[model samples]
Target: MAPDPPDDPYVLHARLLAADEAAFREVYEAYVPLVLGVATRVIRDRTAAEDVAQEVLSHLWERPLSYDPARGPLRAWLLVLAHHRAVDWVRREEKRRGLAAPHEAPRGDETADAATDGLVALRVRAVAAGLPDTLREPLLLAYYGGRTYRQVAAELGIPEGTAKTRLRTALRVMAAALAAEGITP
Candidate 1:
């Protein structure tokens, strides 16, 4: 039979909670591939995905208490962290490329205009990322997913009124996030 996998994640987490370096290393080794895979799937850039994977692993080591077993399994938590980080990276990259939305190109010197556009786009994406899933799901479905609000409600299994509420709330939250990011939106 194949050798048994490493110790239980809870056991490993317990060791981690105790500030055991060895335990952190063990967890890192156990999950790095899975974490990297998740990050790459979302970021679609090997270098950025590696960076996000490292960030996720480092966060786990630095903040062991952040992982509460009650919420879910350790693996799931790690994957979630990886996914979020990857999304952040993708947003940042989108901002960098000024590809968050389409608009007329800046009229100034091309390089300077591109830089300004990038910053604005980045802020937009960062704020969008702050939106809660309740609102985000419907908004993404309606906007990026190219679905109508009705379709979004159907897909999310929420009443259309609830979906509309969520979409409005999400937009409000995104606007606030943008303001916080120092952009007028």
Candidate 2:
């Protein structure tokens, strides 16, 4: 018996790139659930997740040519991009809420807490700086940005599997690095 033919992502991409609405719709319908799943992981809000998914689709429509088969599969690429964008959105939202940064220091308590926060920030920055862009970006998007694995995949423009693998690898390496610095999660 013959094996089923592999789905030609490049052909599909070309059709979508040509602005074939039906082709675009097909891709959207096929992938929205996956995208939403990833977005929700990051934003932790249904509405925002949906919005991010839509944005991801819009980006695909606008720049279909950006999907390069030579680098990796199309699904991975889309998911990575989604993940990155969703995490960015979440981070921005957190900043807007003032949950991430202190607004003003209380006389005595503020000064004490500020120093600790600064120290942690410095350590985190140092660790992050030490990471290559591949690992650092994904880790930041997932942990700091609050995006799901799928969302991270979309943001990075890689496959869901690749995203999962990268996250796992990044976490292990970061854990080891942090442990050496006496930072325990």
Candidate 3:
């Protein structure tokens, strides 16, 4: 997980708007992983995700006023930006590859993505792969392994509340990832 932001967003936002290098660095250190993680969950390419993270952070540095403090917190705003950028990156890649739509099947000439099959399947794998082990293990066990949450708690030796929270966090992560991809899940 990314470290919490070093200071209140408004303070940071003000410093950023003034082009403070220290403020930018602090924001980068605190949130780059989170931004990259979101991008990676959608993109599934380390290089591409790193590019997305850089673009997002650079946008923050170059146009800090674009982030409005009135509407929401800076962190949520950054996540939204990251999501949009990742989706845009995927769309651009698909277009460049001659695929008409994101969900459309890749052409026969295109590489098979190592037998991953459909775009949806690849995206599912990406999202699953991006989840933390604490979240992913229980998610797979409960959903794929057909275990109850109580059983998940017992198996992981965690309290039931922790199990439930993990499940909830996992679902939220999936939902956010899918939503970023413009999928209704």
Candidate 4:
């Protein structure tokens, strides 16, 4: 289980946006495991998962205002980002692997693919339902739908800072909820 961030998520997020490295470190330490878990689940490669997790965190640092509290919680937003990056990595790998099999039939592993997709969808839905609507929708857009934070803000008609605050609040709520469920976020 990851330790909770030292300050409330909103305060931590504000600090992070202001270039507070220590606050950013707290966010990184608290959520890296959850992000790595999602990445590993998709990529099935430890090294690649680590790389992707770093990339996700880096993205957060570069675009701290993308997280919106009104749209959903922060954990979900980060997980969604992790998941999308992992999926993108997997897809790129598939493409690379496919290039070596130009003469082979398309990898028609339909059943397995369908099952995996179904399971991911179900889990995402369950997690989203567990979140308040304010945190759920924006996180979903950024994470699951692969929209950028700017895009999410545009769609929600809110300023980017507000979006980030919503995202942080959402993450705090999720962390608490996961704790209650005997799970760590």
- The candidate that wins on lDDT is 3
Q: Write the per-residue lDDT of candidate 2 for residues 4-111, one digit (tens) a residue.
A: 124477777678778988878777777888677767766678899899999988988988766555444455555656666665686677677876554432122243
Displacement of residue 61 (Cα, Å) in model 4 is 0.6
Please list the residue runs of candidate 3 whose C-alpha ends up more than 4 Å from where it truly belongs after superposition. 1-3, 102-185
| Candidate 3 per-residue C-alpha lDDT over 30-100 given as tens digits, one digit per residue, 9 for 90 to 100 | 88887887777778788999999999999889888777554445665676577667777887888897876
- Candidate 4 or 3, higher lDDT: 3
Whole-model lDDT per candidate: 0.69, 0.68, 0.75, 0.71
In model 3, what are the clashing residue pairs, if there are any?
Answer: none
TM per candidate comes to: 0.52, 0.51, 0.54, 0.54
Candidate 1's TM-score: 0.52
For candidate 1, the 10 contiguous residues with the lowest summed lDDT are 104-113
- Tens-digit lDDT track of model 4 for 95-164: 7877534444333235434544554454445656778777887888887889877888889998988778
Q: Could you report the Cα RMSD, in angstroms, for every candidate shown?
A: 11.5, 16.9, 10.6, 13.1
- For model 2, what is the error of residue 1's alpha carbon versus the real structure, in angstroms, after optimal superposition? 25
Question: Which 10-residue window in model 4 sums to the lowest lDDT?
Answer: 104-113
Q: Where is the poorest 10-residue window by lDDT in model 2?
A: 104-113
- The parts of candidate 2 lying over 4 Å away from their true place are 1-7, 102-185
